[model samples]
Target chain A: MTLLQRLAGSARREPRGTLRVVDPNPLNWLYITYNTVEEPVRVTRRGKVRPAAMSSYRWRGSRTMEIRVRPGGRFADGTSLDACSVHRSFTEQTRWHSPHPPGTHFNIDPRTRAEVVDERTVRLHLPEPDGLVLGKLRATHVMSERFWRDLGFGYARDETGEGHW
Target chain B: MIDAPGPWASGPFTLVEGRSIISTEPVVTDGEDRTWLQTEDRSPTVRLRANPHYWDRVRGPRVREVEFRNDVDRRRALDLVCDTVGEVDIVTEVPHREAERVRRSRHARLVAVDSVRALAGAIDRGVDGLPLDDVRARRALNLAVDRSALVRDLFGGHARPLAGLTPPTPLTALHRAPGRLRPYPYDPSRAARLWQAAGGGSRPLRLAAMTDWEAVAHAVAAQWHTVLGLAVEVRILRSDEEQREARRRQAAKEPRDWDVLLLEQGSQSADVPPLELHRAFVGRSGEFRAGPVDPKFERLFDHLRSRRSQLWQVLAANRLDRYVTDQALALFLVAPRVLYAVNERVDFQPYATTFELADTSVRRGHWSLR
Candidate 1:
């Protein structure tokens, strides 16, 4: 299959199929093909957010959310996806510079921390009570630890001319 | 221009290096070659192959490889898609003017979907000596134009009259109750009466718009001129630089040259939730706001943002939508449908938000290598 874009412009510098997923460019179409993440919630066709990667989630308190990941998920690199990986991905995403506008930055807020409670559970500690936290987590993508080690941050191309995560 | 490599993240198709190529010419190849053809002026084409390690093996990517090409001219893009030989499988956007042509093409099919996008006029209420400062006058402006006629005549019935800032999508319908939130009916007499009550004079309103919105601006100007007997000068911003400068001026509240700015709203993905759409349009720091912020709207928005319950937030959003319409913050126009030209051979399903080909496949017997 072949796709055509009407406009001609420079490709974005942000690595494709990563945590930074706010912009709706053609590159975004490739996000699902390359990255794996337990979206805390998925927006339905009618625009309602329902549980996706996570089997279930609930608010522990005003600023804390306990999420239970669905079992049997794996990254493209063949690594098992669990609570610790989710915590690491969320933490790393917070530290990365976001190219999107502040309002559209859906990654866990920088002040928020991700805590792994068990193998399948992760707790998100937001700085303030947010009604849209689950919706916000939809933009966050989880990559294998090996991906971070190999690609590090930002756009990286090895001698083979392949993009890093 | 870095190419996507394989196996970094988990998608259905990994970026196949070497086999994946970018070229200016329409070269269809499944050979493993490291050919990267790029020219100074032409947009490059990209190709991707399916991932063997894809988790859902049963469903399958189905196709072995996919290619993407960028066409600088939309007309040419449409032409290629409608070609009898099927040079291209799908084209992302078909210009509204050429939608009819695509519809008539035997080799191509026109996929028109309801877009979240809306075309509206941002009134500069802070501009002194204008009746737009008055909410009744603003409402009068919205009421004066015939949105239905605009859709029929201008869009060829390819659009829906916008009742508020957001388009009438299923998501938006959840908040806006029927009859409670409806578009201001076309009533030129009522508009004239309101304008007269607001002490509106013969001051010629200056309307600024981009090249794309020139037609709508002119039609709106004509309507205002005929209905309220108000002369409107439509200034066309031809270049991106000029549009950027106009936006900067609008933001700084400097150079009060234009009383209204005719522009498109929701250029972002159509899948955006109604709450986020509201934040993007009327929030204190909204990107599309061209005039002075309203304190009432600010308070309402702040409340909506602070709420923790989804139900409360939805209700608040409904209230906010109603408030913006009632206050007539902007002249709501039509929600145009997104158009796509797809080759007959491609089994493509258009996404409401973005142009996606991930789930798309070719009909078994119909698709053949050129």
Candidate 2:
């Protein structure tokens, strides 16, 4: 198995993480609050207009990814878009980044384990952490790394080459 | 989807130039003396004199004959070199052991530089070198390493093991590791204390790893579990799936659901900025590299990304050291070199350092046809 498989999952094993299914055609102004499991996802905002606070924005904290069923929708920043949404989003910095130098150690308060109890069954435990951070989850979404490496491509950085290795 | 020709396939050496069958008579130029056959090996072995009609004044190959035996086979290559039948030169990819052996026993010349990724430690090529921020923690971890053991066991001492990556080209300021980046060894006790201080004992770390890195991840996990008594589970992400996750993170076009990724970045080139690393974890990368977040670093990162103000960009990149040191989201292990073994008659330099070997030419006067 390769590093990618370890990050996602080996082919032999089942994948862990939440899964979700959204309507293919979400209505304009669709406010999605799904569980991404992890906190703060990267986003490209609606209507090509750039975000004023572009880099400082956090997907989880605010409206990250917004699309328009109707182009030229009204934006939070009072910008106009085509009848469809534009692509611009906010990015959030992690809590563990240190401002020192390269090769310095930045550590995370890792949440290592979770289990499924029932149909929609899920219980998460992050020992000694503060606050309940809600996130989006999509079971139907996660891809198996092993499946692909075995299938080819996306193996690891070292595994990359011209044609399929 | 890619019918477009690549650099090597389209020019100088065309892909269509390859022979379909070994026995097929090769296409010949008007003034060339050698009539040749394309031997299934893709490379052609020909005995050619100077083309009288050639426009260039340059003399051709030194040797009268040139032989290509498909891909060079190692043992057979060595024997050919040893016997001096059709070979007098050979290059070994394994630097320390094989190069040393060839030099001593086989009497082959040896030149060692970084040739391939080392067996000394695991390399995580992710954008976020965050988790490795704390000099003490990083050093402590390095101290716990058994470099000699890894070198001996995994590579049979063919690699010169070190705590960090050796830049392929001449030293630029970027290649140097600050005094704080020193390595740690296998000290369970120190790891325990560091873990306790870093809140490792306080929570469970969802240890993300790729299948290739599973053994190393488990080893670290075992150390964490045993020494620090920290609860951790090692999760393996497949390769392609991880790439899909990375592409999603990069494009900001898709969603991610992992805690951390054990992966390598595409490049360290300034042109290849560390933005991807920033986005991989803490940024809105589907929370793949989620957080126990740091606001100061985040603020600087924000400034760095937005402050197209030239003076500020340098400050931001410099600040990168800070951001990476504090949180330790992604850890960079080590960078290795590419290893290749060639037949004695094959003359080649460690092709230029860019990692692209397509158009690399062999050193003159060294290569000969068998």
Q: What TM-score would each prediction reach against the true structure?
A: 0.80, 0.41
* Cα lDDT of model 2 by residue, B2-82, tens digit: 011111101011111111112212221112211122112122321112111111112111222222232445455554544
> lDDT per residue, candidate 1, B71-136, as tens digits?
334566666667654456666656677789988987888878776677888787777777777888
Residue A95, model 2: Cα distance from true site in angstroms: 36
- Cα lDDT computed for each candidate against the true fold: 0.62, 0.31
TM-score, predicted candidate 1 vs. hidden true structure: 0.80
Candidate 2, residues A1-165: lDDT per residue as tens digits?
566764553322211111111111111001111110001221111101111111122222221222221222222123332211111100011111211111111111233223333222223333333111111111011112222234212123223211111
lDDT of 1 by residue, A60-151 (tens): 88899898976876766677767877787677666543412223324356788788999999999889877666767665556568766665
Reference A-B contact fraction recovered by candidate 1: 0.15
Provide chain B TM-scores across all predictions. Answer: 0.84, 0.51
lDDT at residue B115 of model 2 (Cα atoms): 32
Structure candidate 1, residue pairs in collision: A1-B67, A2-B67, A33-B11, A34-B9, A34-B10, A34-B11
Deviating ranges (above 4 Å) for candidate 2: A1-165, B6-188, B197-208, B230-260, B266-318, B351-353, B363-370
